[model samples]
Target: MSNIQKIGNPARQSNNLLFKRRSILKTLSLAALLPVGLGAYPSGIVIAADGVPLPENVMTPDAALKRLLDGNKRYVSGKISVRDFNVNRAILAKGQNPYACILSCADSRVAPELCFDESRGDLFVTRLAGNYASLDILASLEYGTAVLKAPLIMVLGHTDCGAIKAGMKADKENVDFPGHIQTITSELKSAVKEGVKLPGNATDNVAKENVRLNVAKLKESTPILRQLVADKKLMVVGGLYHLDTGKVELLT
Candidate 1:
């Protein structure tokens, strides 16, 4: 039942994994069958095990937001149970067709899967100190969108982000970086500038603005994403994760 075992043994499908997958598919089918307010229990339908069904398609910005919000709600409420490591490992042995590409900070507190309540093979994540867009990151994102055909891309930032804080305090006389840390600080300077204009805590403001700025930059700087957006083939979104509340608010 270990994660590695579950993944390595393809022929074995745990009862939990099978049940969950079936429930997810059923929920999606039911949602499609039931119109907005016409079904018997149509006020709103909750999936089995309290897990929300991902949207049938995530090609549009609105659909992407809905999917992430559902996942975050499950995460915030402590309802995530899909981490059957063995099963996931096996599933991923074939390949990963993650539904979304996430660009997030290297902050220890901001593990993307935990925040979004996703399991292995569910997300394609690229982590850097400031969630800054670099050439390599952009190339990876292109692979996710164009090759993997992931429907969504998200720039995730969190409150109390250390990278942003470092950038904001970069003016210190003795500031020093041994390796690529200086590059991270430099990339975060624009976020720091944007954060200063907001009215609340500097760190929180910077984190939120950083997410927005990164998303904007991804859309503007990458021809692949730009073409995707223009053709309505993909969606790009920004979100801020609150550590205290375990809530993720979509910025756009």
Candidate 2:
């Protein structure tokens, strides 16, 4: 899908839409049977296909992070709470009021919605080959917070990222990349330079550093973002997605 589709997406406007709604009693029974706490939805709240509700219950940054982690645990344990996207599509057709914005890599293996176990319309996501933040990406995130009032932003990186390796190899061999691919390579070189100074694998460490670098940039960003952070109205953090375990570890 295109980046626009990955973002809040076009309005889901269909008056005739309707689908199966899980009985509240049945949902309560299911919740009681599960050992782990399923992420919260407001009482009598309908969970549409986008597993998570559009207007998330997270008020604080910590709560938002906890909600995501809770979802990841369910994903890791193969106990994903039932989501009715068909119903979600109908409910979200009018407008979306998502709570958190995610800056994640374009790796096929790393899906923010699935990893966070959030349903559609719950997250505002911007993606590229590397999880680096460029001016355009930063501008979009600013809009997400400034206009949409999203309270949290997460820069999510991952293990064995191809973009990191490509940059590492390019830096080591002084290979010149063709076309616009050079843009991502150049952005990542600084992280590779810093990563090489660390104590672990080259690409792996650089990938983590990339998340930190971007998170720092967002935290210190000017105009909208900086003011929001200063007023404690918004938070920008970093995370590393563990592909094998399907868990996201907080980095900053």
Residue-wise lDDT of candidate 2 within 1-252, one digit each (tens)?
Answer: 533334432222111111113322343454354332223333443445444345455468777777878888888888887887787677676445577899999999999999888887778899999888776676678666665567899999999999999899889999878987877888887799998789977777999999998898788744557778998989899999988898888899
lDDT of each: 0.70, 0.75
In model 2, how many backbone clashes occur?
8
TM-scores, each model vs. reference: 0.73, 0.77
Residue 180 lDDT (model 1)? 63
lDDT of 1: 0.70
Model 2, C-alpha of 48: deviation from truth (Å): 16
Give lDDT tens digits, candidate 1, residues 1-252. 544354443222222332344444643564355433211223333232322233233345566567778989998998876666776464345444567889988888888888878777678899988787775787688777765567789888888888887887783443766676777777777788888888979888988888888788777665556777787778888888888988988886
Choose the strongest candidate by TM-score: 2
lDDT of 2 at 245: 90
- How much is 94 displaced in model 1, in angstroms? 1.6
lDDT assessment of candidate 2? 0.75
28 Cα displacement, candidate 2 (Å):
46
Question: Model 2: which ten-residue window has the lowest total lDDT?
Answer: 11-20
